[model samples]
Target: MGNSQRNDGVQLQDERLRGEQLRDEQLQDEQIRLRRPAGIRSLQLGDVKVTYVPDGAIRLTPRGWLPATTDDVWAEHAAYLDETGHLVASVGGLLVEHGDRALLIDAGVGPLSVPAEPGNAVGAIEGGALLASLAEIGRDPGSIEAVAFTHLHMDHLGWAHHPAPGTDGPAFTSADYLISEPEWTHRHLAEEHGTSEEMLAALEPRVRTVNDGDEIFPGVRVMLTPGHTAGHAAYVITGGGRRLIAFGDAMHSPVQIGHPEWWATVDHDTEQSTSFRRGLVEEMSRPDTIGYGMHFADVVFGRAVRGAAGEGARWEPVDA
Candidate 1:
């Protein structure tokens, strides 16, 4: 072949290699984006519908968050951690709707986001999409009858206190804010744990204390499961033939289902929290029962199932 012909063939090969390299890089970027926490998901409980509306997510330092865990434990279970070497915990609210009335459980972390820092176990927190997510589901903010809280944490109350993105007032300004009676009576406990006075004031006007077993909404009842906080409560929604327990912060990540004793350092009473977690895991493992782990990234909604004899127990993500 002529020298010019040979040179032309070589140039074409180089161009093809560059194109392939670009495509590979693009694919890698997409995968990483998927791994990052964000988005909305829903699952139906018989006739009632439960949706996990996204606000944002946070990274929890594995060892720092769960003091009991060591390098070896994390190494053995690395899939729960993300690219940033932290456990990906989503921050959002669970919507329970029956008929035209709707109830929002936990308002979600608001729009503000932060980078990981030293000393603190939580990393890179941000929120502010709860309202939009609600809208996406064809529900109006004012249409919600109430906002029942699992606890009084800043992340959960972010949208509850802050004004909607475009307005000067909170999105659910008109809805009654239901708090477990114990949580409200001792709101001071949450105050010391990062909850600001400003947030408390924002919620004070609309707060309506509810008791355990109270029927907060149709087919929904409150079950007091304290420990993560002074009076954290989980909601059980039963409709059709199935039930879904929106166990807010009782267990942050699905990994907790396997090792309930590994409580987060932020938990008010680790002993009590562990006890509640064990019972909760068993309760959710039963047939026709599902769990809503709000902080479980990607799988905001899932089921706690009894593992095989060798595998112990684990969580299975139920599409929502």
Candidate 2:
């Protein structure tokens, strides 16, 4: 071959090889993001630190949990599902720390577990490591200043209401339990959703009903976005020119970022929940905002980004 032709051929071959390697790397990343469970992940937002303290995980029946989704949808998004054909959801609370002060967003499913039942929206689930997870990160449960909830759900109130292992009293005795005003006033409705009346009583003394826009902690403010429940609240933490929204059950899976209209079966008001989700997804897509999805499996922390024109937003997982 001529010298010029040989040079061009070699360059083309190198470009092809590089393209293949890039594709392989992207595939590997997607596998890790979709298939694995998340460990305790910590990230910094200026002076404040945010961590996802994993208590446990649950399996959600795709069609049953997200009634708006269909078999075809699951089939196309099989990577998000596990071997058992269920979407894996990480159950835990978000720990926010500023200097020596710490706040826990949710208590997690306490020292308990449940077996999967046929035809149920959820599958086998377990928790109890929240305390241990906290200890591993070197934060004392007692040091937590307050336990703020997005809503009164069993998983979120788990460690708050349930007793510490082998103890008669619940853990974090000194911390106040922060609940949204509406959620507190309509606490009775939580019983139908999974939180028991007994649990409500346990938290009664420490419960402090907060209003929207309340600055519950340094750099953290409550943004009440109900619909998942009567008074669901999302905590917005701002610092160092960036903000993180701990959008509790507003979205249980990363998939919902693209299809916010697919309300979960647990949502108290489907239309409202769907509307909030759409706005939430858009807000999270902003350049300076990140989202924390407590039940987003391994992809707990992510940013929503706009897709092609006419397409909905999609989630891009962020690493600590």
Candidate 3:
């Protein structure tokens, strides 16, 4: 072969080898992502220990979950979904511990799962691991001083009301179930959105109505973040010179941080939800600010960052 042709051939071979290596790296990355840890994860803010306990998971239908999203939007973010073509939403509680005292936020979806239906936002929902996860973290049900709910949603209050299958009574029976005042006053409205009357009755005795800014637990105060429900709330925990906002249903996934206008189908008021989400995005952007997205799949603890688009910002998971 001519010298020039031989040189060109070698260059082409090198390019092909580089391309193969890049593809292999991409495949390995995808594999690692699919193997992400699913259960309990912990982060420490100075002396406070925060854990995202896994009860189970729900498969969210892209369009059904967020009615505002179109197929085109889903197309642009196909990587977020699992193999089943569903967005895997973690369903559990956040266990916040400070010294000797412990406060459980959002009790998690108990041991019940429903199959998805034709237009359902969730394809399937199942949870029965909160108690076990707590036990794994060396926390007993009774150890929790109080169960502060972010909202009156069934998933958030499940373990509090639903009696364990093999146990005598409901878990956390000894502790008070702290609910937002407006949420408790207008409890009837939540029933339509799948919060059953049975659950309301079960939790009624232990319910304590707290208002916005109420300091129910040490270093934790309620912030009225409505729209997801009548009295949906977010808890702000400050300790060791840092702040972590356990923003409940205010944000279902990190993707919402990039698009505050995408309200959940379950949101009580879309306009109000968007407003709170926008403000939250800004709050999360500040230094020393971390957020706990209650339903964020694997990387539940993340911080919002200024996004490329004007929509707002995006959520970047914090390994700590």
Highest TM-score against the true fold, candidate: 2
* Candidate models: Cα lDDT each: 0.85, 0.91, 0.85
Q: Summarize candidate 3's per-residue lDDT along 1-320 as a digit string, tens digits.
A: 99999999999999999999999986555434422435678889888889888898888887889889999997887767777767778889999998878999999989987898887787888888898898898998887879999988888888988887678678785789899999999899989878999899999988999988989987899999889999988999988888999999997766688888899998999899999998898899998899998788877887887956655686677767
Q: Is candidate 2 or candidate 3 better by TM-score?
A: 2
What is the lDDT, from 0 to 100, of the residue 164 in candidate 1? 83
Instruction: Give TM-scores for every candidate, taking all chains together and pairing residue i with residue i.
Output: 0.87, 0.94, 0.88
- In candidate 2, stretches whose alpha carbon ends up further than 4 angstroms from where it belongs are 1-20
What 10-residue stretch in candidate 1 is worst by lDDT?
27-36
Over 4 Å off in model 3, which ranges? 1-37, 309-312
* Clashes per candidate, residues 3 or more apart or on different chains: 4, 0, 0
Candidate 3 lDDT at 79 equals 67
Per-residue C-alpha lDDT of model 2 across residues 24-126, encoded as one tens digit per residue: 9976786666655678998899999999998998889999999999999988888788888888889889999999999999999888889999999988888
